[model samples]
Every structure is written in C-alpha cells, then in structure tokens.
Target: MKRNRNFSLLLFVVFLGILFITFSVISVEARKYRVKKSKPHKHQNDRNGNGNRNSPGPAPAPLPHYPTRSTIFDVMSFGAKGDGVSDDSKAIIAAWKAACKVSGATIEIPSNFQFFLKPITLQGPCMPNLVLQIDGTLLAPPNVGSWPKSSLFQWINFKWVQNFTIKGTGIVDGQGYSWWKYSSIYFLQKNSKHIPDMKPTALRFYSSYDVTVRDIKITNSPQCHLKFDSSRGIKVDNITISSPESSPNTDGIHLQNTQDVEIHNSNFGCGDDCVSIQTGCSNVHIHHINCGPGHGISIGGLGKDKTVACVSNIIVEDISIQNSLTGVRIKTWQGGIGSVKNVSFLNVQVSDVKIPIMIDQFYCDKKFCKNQTGAVGIRGVKYDRIIGTYSVQPIHLVCSNEIPCTDVDLIDIQLKPSPGYRGFHQALCWNTYGKSQAPLLPSSIDYCLGKNGDPVKRIEKSHEHVC
Candidate 1:
C-alpha cells in the first residue's frame, strides 16, 4: 500500500512539471508575436517616414545631362521677328554661328514664318553634318536699290562648307521683278557692256563638298536659280524652279567646275536651259526631270574666249520635255578647245520641242560671231530610245569641221512632226560620224551613210586631247 502511495506522489509531480513547460513555451511565443507587431517592414517605413530603417533610400539616380540625338538651334530663339517686313538675316546668321560649332546640329527656321533676308554669304568650314532646315519662306529683298553693288552677284551663297544639307518644303523667293525690268532695258541698248552686271543668282554653293539641296521651291530669279561653282559631291532633288518664260539667263541649275553631281526628280519651267553643264563637270547623272518653256539640257558654249575645257561621263535619262526649245543638246563655241566624250541620253520623251536631239559645235549666241577654226571635240555621244513629236526638226547634228564628232550612236529614235507642222520631216547632219542601229522613224539621217547610201561602220578615233 505504501509503495502505491509513493508512485501516485511521483505521478502528480510529473504532471505539474509538464504544465509548467507548456506555459513557458506559450509565453515565449506571445513575446515573439508582440515584438513582430511592434516593428514595421523596411519598405513601408521608408514610404511613411523620412528615413529608412537603416538610412534613406539612395537619392534617385540623377537624370543624365546630355544633348539629344540632334541639337537644334532655332532662329526664333535667336531673336528673329518672323514678320515679312522685318530683317531676319541677323537672326539667321546668329543661328548658323551657334550651329556651326556643334556636330550634327540643325538650324531650324520654323514654319509659318516669312523671313526677309538680305544678300548674305554663309561661309563655313563647319562641323560635320551641318543642316539648314528651312521650313519657312526666305525672301530676298524686293527693291533692287536695297542691294549693295558688290552683292548683286549672289543672293544666298554657301561657301567652303562640307557635308551640308539645305532642305524642307519652303520657298526661296528672289524678288527679281525689279532687276528683270532693269536688265530688259539694259539689254535693249546697242552697247550693253557699259551697264554693270546687276542680276544676282538666287542660290549658289561655291567650293562646298557633299552638299545637298532638296525639297525646296525657288522662283523668279534674276539669273540662275541655283548654281554650283567649284564644288563637288552635289545632289539636288525634288525641287521646283520657275520663272517667266521670257526671263533671260535664268538657268534652273547651272554647274560649272562641279563634279560628281546628281540632279533628279525635279520640275523646271524657266527661260534658259533647264540644266546648264559648263566646263570641268563630269560624272553627272540627271534623270526623271520635267522641263518645259525653256531651253532643254545643254552641255556647253564651252571653250569660249579660246580657253581650254574638258567634260566627260554625263548620263541624262528618263526625261520629259514639253514646249521646250531643244532636247538634249550640246553646244560649243567655234574657237574653244576641249574634249566632250561619253555623254548618253536615254529614254527621253519630247512634246512640241524644236529639236529633239542636236549637237551644235558652232554655237554662236551673239548676233554675229567671227568664224574660227578650233573646236571642242565631241565623241562617244549616244541617243537611245528618244521618242515623241518635235515642232521644227527631228534631229540636227551639226558638228565642227575642224574636230568632227566621232563614234556617235543613235538607236530606236522615233520623232514625229507635230500637228500643224507644214515643213518636211528631215534630219540634218553635218560633219558627224555615227551609225543608226535601227531605222529611225519619220526620216533617216542620210549624213550617217556612205557614198553608196549604206549605213557606215564607226571608225574608232583617238580621243586624246590637250585640254
């Protein structure tokens, strides 16, 4: 019985020990829960309070301070009034000065503005890729009296610039009416040499490289609408040039001593040659042009004043000429010394043109030019796929007797006489040596035939010239 009582006491003590261990575990868990409830998450504390649990979140990474892809220098920001009457030349010059220092800079002339600019030459050896974005109209001073005597040669001139671009759908209006009137009266005089040369070209690039002028409309120029002289790597596209049909000497684009030129997809309605290729020009490609009411593309009047000239590698293709004086003509003065070689005219369509294809070596512009013996050599000229109607003649190839044209080729030419044309459809050829591939429509050039009236074979001539 005593043994059983001792066992019961030991069992009661074991039960009490088990109850105490369970209470201690529950108390420790409660303390842990209280501590967790008192503390807040780090992110939540950072949002609700100034400091983080340890320190404030690092200050937001400062935004990078650098120029955008292309920095712009707007003319308006340079104090341009933009009113038609105000002089904006100063503002434009300021913008260009700022842009010239930075590479890949664009000088922006904003839209809805008519800026009257004086005769100015923007000279540059600027940072690469300088751009002139002309979204507004740039007007030359209206009155001729406003121009200084020295500035009458060019209205807007770009000189010595490289990798430059002038673009945007804007109008460059040379208010040339006053100058034209003065010129008309001056030309009527018997001896006009005394009259100072007053007409100014609308736009000119001199000694600039890799220049591009596109998407611009130039109108009513006193002289040439656009000119590149002593420049290289020129590209002119998608531009419109216009003037009165009787406006004299307003060639659409005049190239002199410029090489590696490309002029395409442009429309021209002017008084003079739509494109005038002067001396020292080569590797030129002119295509997809619309020309009318003007003299068609011309290569010369080169070697004037008994000077030496050289031109080569010219290709004019896919052209449309309507109501033009002549189509695809190369003219050189009588006394010039040069070699014009490797010129091709392909796929040209004409409507009411005076002469569809011509090469006039004895081209005399004045009333009377004294006959001279020396001439510019014309060789390797090809006219292929020339089709349409001509008002005066189908073909007139009058080369120089001194240096006759050689290796000329005509293939697939179909030029019909225009309606109401009573003259005979004849092709005139003199001092030209060439062969016709297929039978020319309307009339065949008998000059390209042998004495027995058969197509003559071309004799390869030596083309080395001193010029």
Candidate 2:
C-alpha cells in the first residue's frame, strides 16, 4: 500500500509542472501580440493636429488665388509681346506697377504664349489681396556676359510685399544649360577652389508677409530655384522643381531669416540641398516631399565665418528621399555661437541614401578650413520611424566636444545596407549623447546608445569616414 501511494504522488507532481509550462507559453505569445500592434505609424502632418497618416491618396493641385477680376492688369496690354523672343521685361513691370495700386487686383499672364524677360524687379507696397497669375510660360535670358557686374543674384525679385498670392500652371524656365558647363558636381569636386559663381535664382521674395505660392513649375535655375528672405507667414504647396543631378549649387528652395513657413506636397531634384534652412529661422514645417538624385535636405552650415545664428522648432515628416547623398542632416560651423533646438525628423523613408542621419558640428565648405573652438549648441532632437537602406554608414552623430548634443532620442529605426553591399559593424559617433528604446534594428546599437551614451568611449574609433 505504501509503494502505491508514493507512485500516485509522483504522477500528481508531474501533471502540475506540465500545466505551468503550458500557461507560460500562452502568456508570452499574448504579450508579443500586444507589443507589435502598439508601434507608431506615420503622423498626418508636422503642422496640423491630426493623428497618424496611412497611405493617403493622391492630392490634386488647388486653384489659383480668389482675387476679383474687375481690377485685372494683363501683361500683354502693357506692351508685353508673347512671342517668346521679344524683351518683355518692361511690359511685365508696367503691369505690376499698375496693379499695385488697386486692392484685390490680379496681374494676369494668359496662356497659349511665352514671354522672354531679362532681369526684373516687381516692387510692391501692393494693395491688399493682390495676385500674380501665371498661366503662360516665362523664359529667362541665358546671357550671363551682359549681366550687371554687381547684383542681388535674383532674376525676379518681389520686394516688400504683403498679403499676396502667386499661383498658376505656368512654367518658369531659367535656361541654365550654359551655366552648367563649368559648374557641375564633378568639376567642383575635381578642382576644389576654382568654381565659377552661377547666375541668379529664378525668384526671390525679400521681407514679405502673408504670402502663398502654389502650383508652379520652376526648372533649371542658375542657383536656387526659389528663395525667401526675412519673410513671415509663408505657404508653398504643390510646386515642382527639377534640374540635372550634376547642376552645381542649384538648390530647390532656400530660406533665411524666415518664420512660420510651411512647404508641402513638393518634388525637388537638384545638385545642392533640396531645401536649405539658414540662420534666424523658426517654426518651419516640411511635409509630403519627394526628393531624388540630389544632395537631399539640410539645415545650414549655420554660424559660418564666426557669425551668430539661431534655428528652432523645425519639423520634417512623411518625406521620401531616393538616390540622394543624405536623408536628413544638420551642419554647423566650428567657430560660432548659436543654437539649434527642438528639431524633429519623423516618418522619413529612403532608398540608396549615402548617409541616413548625420549631425556635423564641424562643417566646412571652402577650399580650406581653420579649426576653431566656438560651437553651436544643439539640443532636443528626435528621430522617429526612419526606415531605409543606406549606401554607406547608416548613422553618424558627431557633436562638438565642448557643447555636446543633448536629449537626442531615437525610436523605431530600421536600416540596412544597400543591396549586395557589406554592412558596417556599427554606427559611427563622436562626442554625441543620445538614448534609444526598443524597435531599433541591429539591436547591438542599443548597447552603444544609453543615457548620456558616448560611442567613442565605448567602441573603437575608425578613420574610415574623414569629415
């Protein structure tokens, strides 16, 4: 009887152990299911209050400005020949001058014709609610030899304007092929210092307020396609800018000393930075952009030449960059006192990019650079949902040793090497500090980035990437 009772006890113990093992397996599977569903999707906009956006449909171009047609001033009526060969600069200027006097007026360039213009300035203390509608094409004179020696480097200048809209399906062609002969990426790289300065950008707005630019096609600029300086409350939507990959210094859009600006639904491919944010800029938002075959988007070599600079509250989201040298970057000169804070790059996708994320505290573009000590303070930056394939190193965060980058956070980052290429052992970092959470691929990097993590101290330094 004793033997039978002992055998019964042993079987009961075995049954309980089996039951515990089964329950543990079920609990682990349930927890993993919950975590997978909780990760973030792309946000709707960087500016708006909407939630995450998921595979939105195509967006159509909006209509032109809603100015009253009663006070219309047509360029053709002011002796502007629409023959594509005549000098129409004087006539276009006359129309702008006349329309500037009337409220809600429109300077209309009608379709079915082309106008060739030399350099022109459309000065404005324009009446409120003015619109410049370009339904026809405007061609720029390609003769750089005859241009004035001293210049503002702008083909069309809209100065001191307020409460205006410039919209249409028309094209602005810079005819920049002649300018590109000696000004290409290859030539500039081969001959380090002797690059020729290109001509003017197609359009520039100086000290403007409450402006809207929509539905325009700008092509082949000598410098940047469009530029804005010291402007407030600007919006640019549904614009297309294109140039060859080799075109030198042909940035798509450049801004300096601008505030409260939004650029959305745009496409850009040029030699230089697709969108460059210079000094004294704040509250800028860029969304739904497509960039390709160019240098990619960048925040300035701020504080250059030992100048003070400031940029803050910038956001870039839902962007696609392919075949570009970089995905998102911030560069600052070595000898300057300034700060870049509250910058966020979210939901960016890239393919074949050389460097996906980079922060260079020492940025030098000249033929020679003299190292100095003063540095820009960089803080409060976040990288979220950056997924892509990179041609070279996936991440580079080189901050100044004196003023280390603080509060840099990374979440949901997944990057791999480009096809058929050998992946690097780890990300490169120097004098950088950051934190990372789960959902980061190459999970080993998590070991590198912790609270106040410095990669150089923990990992071996590499000389593979020199500046």
Candidate with the greatest TM-score versus the true structure: 1
Worst 10 residues of 1 by lDDT: 451-460
Name the TM-score of candidate 1: 0.83
- List pairs with backbone clashes in candidate 2: none
TM-score of 2: 0.79
Error in Å for residue 171 of model 1: 0.4
lDDT of 2 by residue, 254-326 (tens): 9999999999999999888889999889999999999987878899888888787788899999999999988
In order, the Cα lDDT scores of the candidates are 0.87, 0.83
What overall lDDT, based on C-alpha atoms, would model 1 receive against the true structure?
0.87
Counting clashing residue pairs in each candidate, in order, gives: 0, 0
Model 1 residue 251 distance off true place after TM-score fit, in angstroms: 0.4
Please give the RMSD of candidate 1 to the true structure: 8.2
Against the hidden reference, what TM-scores do the models get? 0.83, 0.79
